[model samples]
Target: MAVTRSLSTLIFDLGNVVITWDPRPALPEQYTGQDAEDLLTRLDFFTRNADHDAGKPFAEWVADLRSSGDAEGADALQHYVDHFDRSLVGLVRGTSQLIDDLKAAGVTLYALTNWSAETFHHAQAAAPALAQFDDILVSGEEGIAKPNPEIYTRALERWDLDVRTTGFLDDSEANIAGAESVGLTTHLFTNAVDARAWARDMTGAAGV
Candidate 1:
C-alpha cells in the first residue's frame, strides 16, 4: 500500500543526489597509473574521507596521514585539496528541474547534507542550482553527520516541521534509517531520476 500524506516539506541530500563527486577523477598527474591505484587502495580514500565529513580539518588529516608514514596518502589528500572543485564534476541531471517543479508546486525545500565545512563553498560555487534550497544544514558546521539522529532532529526542529509530514531523501540506507527513526518519511535514493519521481509523487508536484 502506498502511504499517502501531505508532504509539504522536502529535504534533499547534496552529495550524489544533487552533484557528482568522484574523488578518483581528481588524481594528480604525478600519481597516475599503478601508483594512483596503489595509493588509493592503501589509503582507503572513501573510508578515511568520512573523517572530513565529520568535521576533521584537512590540515589535521594530512598531518595524521604523513605521521602514519603514508606520504603517498598525504600527497593524494593534497591533490584533492588542489582539485576540490574539479572533484565535484557537476550537477546531477534533472535535479535542478525537479527543484524548480517542487517550488512551483509550493513545496518547501531544504537540504541536510554530510559535507565538510571547508569544502562546501566550492560545491556551492560549482553548482549554483543548490542555491534554490530554502535552507541548508551542514553536518560539519553542526559537528554531526547523518546516521546520527541528532542532525535530523536539529534540521526538523530548526524548521519547526512535523516529522510525519516532512520528506527526507538520501542515498545512504543508514541515513534513511536515521531519518525514519526520527519519524520522517524517508526515501532511499538510487539515482536522480527515481529521486525526482518520488519527490513529485510525495509532494503532488507531478504536473507542476
Candidate 2:
C-alpha cells in the first residue's frame, strides 16, 4: 500500500497563470491586429523569446535579426523590449485572493517562470501578490526553461521540496506535463477559481 502525501507546497507558473503576458500590446500602435501577428510570426517570436528566457541577451538576438536582414523585425523587438512593462497587462483575476488565502493557511508557495532576466523586474513591479511566494526560480537566471525536465528537477532540488507533497500549477499543458514527468502532483490552470479549489482540496486549507 502506498501512503498518500498531503499537499503542503505549491509551485506556480507566472505567465498566464499568475500574470498575463501578451506581446501584442507591447508592439507599436502601427503594428496592431494582423500586422502584429504577422510580425511575431515572421520573426519566429516565440522561439526567440524562448531563447531569451534561457538567458540569451536581447541585444544579441536583435543583432542576429539585423544580420539576417530582418531590420524591421529587429527594430520591432527593440521597441517591445523598451516597452516590456506594457506586456505585463495585469495580474490574473482572483489570483491575488487565492495566493493570499493559501498564504494565510501557511501553505508553502514558490514561483517557477520562463521570463527574460532583463525584463522580469517589470513583472515584479506590476504584481504585488508575487511577494507572497517564498521564492521564485526564474528560467532566465538559470539558463533553463519549462517543458524541460532539468529545470523542474532543479526547482525541486533547490527548494528541498518533496515530489509527493508538492503540487505544480501551470497554464501551459507542456509545463504541466514537465512537472508530471518529474512525479509532481500537477494542476492545469485554466482560471484562478479552479486553481483555488484545487489548492484548497489538496492542502485542506482552512477558510480557503
Total clashing pairs in model 2: 0
lDDT value, candidate 1, whole model: 0.85
lDDT tens digits, residue span 128-185, model 1: 7778898899987888889899999999989899887899998899999999998999
lDDT of each: 0.85, 0.92
lDDT of 2 by residue, 3-93 (tens): 4457999999999988999999988789998999999999899988999999889999899999999898899999999999999888899
TM-score of each: 0.93, 0.96
Give lDDT: candidate 1, residue 11.
Answer: 95
Clashing pairs in 2: none
Cα deviation of 72, candidate 1, in Å: 2.6
Candidate 1 Cα outliers beyond 4 Å, as residue runs: none
Q: Largest lDDT belongs to which candidate?
A: 2
Task: Kindly give the stretch of ten consecutive residues in candidate 1 with the minimal lDDT sum.
Answer: 199-208
